[model samples]
Target: MLSCVVLWSGRRGSRELPRLRPRVAPTSLTRVDFTELVPEPIAFLGQAAYIQLEAFENLARAVATAPSLGAKEGLSAAAGVALRKHHDLIAELRRSGVEPVEVMAPFAPATDRFREASVGADWYELLLGIYVTTGMLDGFFARLSEGLPNELADRVRRILAEEGASQVLRHELERAIAEQPGLADRLALWGRSLVGDTLLVARSALRAAEPSGRIDEDVEPVFTELIADHTRRMDALGLTA
Candidate 1:
């Protein structure tokens, strides 16, 4: 299975955070020939770009109201990363000779609804929400890219790999949990609640790619891996998934 290491600080305690380097299991859908499952190229690019823009917007808002200077700085850096990715994706769209705005417009409503439904009630909840949702979607997009032409696939993979914010968010969440042991139960619940909506966003992307608008049963293993990766992430945080 394809794997990546997630490194975080701190040590294990009874229901407490641990210094972790958990391996994320492969969540790729390429185990079967899935070229036909790839979405229309323009649709894929537009949705990917818009999602990054949304992430940038959310992080920027969090930076504005962050409780501490450290948190503000951390979130601001992550926002910059998201913004740059958005700009890069837009450039890719322009290279394909489409107006970036118009292409992205079609996806706004669905993505917006996903964001609203997953929005957190407070700072900690918001941070975990972003971490979980973005992590899953980024992995999903990377997997989908495998079916794209080689050049586009390479570019998309590179952009997704520049996920510095994931580390920052993980660190922030771990710090919060380490400081407030009582928060583990609540955040654990919040993390679990996010998977259904996040998976819906992912499935919708695949459904849009299919002419019949129905996902294949073969896709089940892909999602199973996604959920496993998600469970590992929550486990790293010493939370029950």
Candidate 2:
């Protein structure tokens, strides 16, 4: 049985952007320079789009491999819901005059590295990754998006609203754990590994996003929130942090 409610209660609240904005060069500035203007938000959106795209594709594969029609249909339905939001995010990027490809370029290494490392993981780990890791990242971006311009933030909220996949994923993992009590130990360890790997990749992406040394002060608070949220998520799934 899941022991924690913090996952539902401790969601990062939406925060509006300050009225006094930083003076940025034009939005039409060069790709390299544009990152300097709004590095984390842009990078966050870009990485979000890339990760969601990959996630839906992976879910589709899982659907295919499912043994029962019931399971396949449930997974498929979740993926279908996710697909619509995925397209919406791409459209929003274009509307914002940002090239999805250009913004996503910098984080390719980290995302790709994560995928490569998980190549041979078992099905439970994959489902748990979707439920825990991806869910947390989605929550993080959704919280940050609240501080963006209204248009961009609305699109991101749409992306974040596609929670069907995570719900289905969480159910599947919980059923597995309930059926096989011993599996919890292994999955708990796997969950920790996933968290560690995710942090490493996130740190690398943060470094790339913030080239200036000034990011030091900003990182600590953001990480404190992330770590706290991560612990909540782990506890919700009956796993130790």
Best by lDDT: 1
Sequence-dependent TM-score of model 1: 0.83
Per-model TM-score versus the true fold: 0.83, 0.73
How far is 16's C-alpha from truth in model 1 (Å)?
34
lDDT of 1 by residue, 1-241 (tens): 1132222111221111211333334454345445656677788889989988888877887798788999999899999998998998899999999999999998899899888776689988888888888888888877887777889989988987786578888888889899996898899889877776777677667766655655655565556666677887787778887
Top TM-score: which candidate number? 1
218 Cα displacement, candidate 2 (Å): 3.4
Clashes in model 2: which pairs?
A: none
Candidate 1 clash pair list: none
Q: What value does the lDDT take at residue 107 in candidate 1? A: 86
Candidate 2 lDDT (Cα, 0 to 1): 0.61
lDDT of 2 by residue, 123-152 (tens): 777777666666656665566566566667
Every model's Cα RMSD, please? 9.5, 11.3
